[model samples]
Target: MDYQPDGQTPYQNTHSQNMALASLILGTLALLTCGCIYFAVVCASLGIIFALLSKGGSLTMNTSGKIGLVLSSLGLAFTLLLYIGLFLYVLKTYGGFDGFMQESLNFYGVDSIEELYQMMGVPY
Candidate 1:
């Protein structure tokens, strides 16, 4: 008897709706900041969390939440790949970790990591 002829549910899950919107916004931010690995990871992680929470114990998510989840996942993947590529490039350019360390020390005008740390009063 409470049903309306329009056939749509009278009550809306406002909390879920808000969460889905937040997820979408955060996912967009994650994608936009993909070049900054740390910032992108944080945004992507929060986006994924918001999307999952938007499900609200339901087995299925609304469309916005699903899109947010996908975008955040892609952002995380891209961040990981960027870091891996950077590491590989560093290894190839420097010949190894030792070479990289040596170059770093030279750049700092120090003979060794311990010397650099001592110069900076880091208790080596």
Candidate 2:
């Protein structure tokens, strides 16, 4: 029952607007959690999906949707780069995945993977 100043019914695009808002929120979360690579990836992916969905049948997206898409994309890229860099660093410093595992187990005073799991209270 909303009307414009000219006494005409206001055009309502509620669904699209809601989708755009969700995209924005998720995009922000993705950016904030970029350091947590896995979480950032999940949030960024969902944000991108919502941003695209907000476009509906239109060829163009609203401002919020566009911003969300950009933010989410950047977040995802940053997360990937961060993880890749960490992996390379670990490989160089530890000699390999096995060396890294050995170091971790030694640091935790665990003789084997099963012992580590038991120490962490995880059922082996």
TM-score of candidate 2 relative to the true fold: 0.78
In candidate 2, residue 112 scores what lDDT?
A: 99
Question: Model 1: per-residue lDDT, tens digit, 1-124?
Answer: 2335687756444348778888898899888888898899999999999999999866789999999998898888888888899899989999988989899999999997788989999985
* Residue-by-residue lDDT tens digits, candidate 2, 1-124: 4556787778544338888888898899998999997889999999999999999876789999999999899889888998899999999999989999999999999999999999999998
User: Candidate 2: misplaced stretches above 4 Å?
Assistant: 1-15, 117-124
Q: Among these predicted structures, which one has the highest TM-score? A: 2
Off by more than 4 A, model 1: 1-15, 104-124
Q: lDDT score, residue 86, model 1?
A: 86
RMSD of each: 3.7, 4.0
Indicate which candidate wins on lDDT: 2
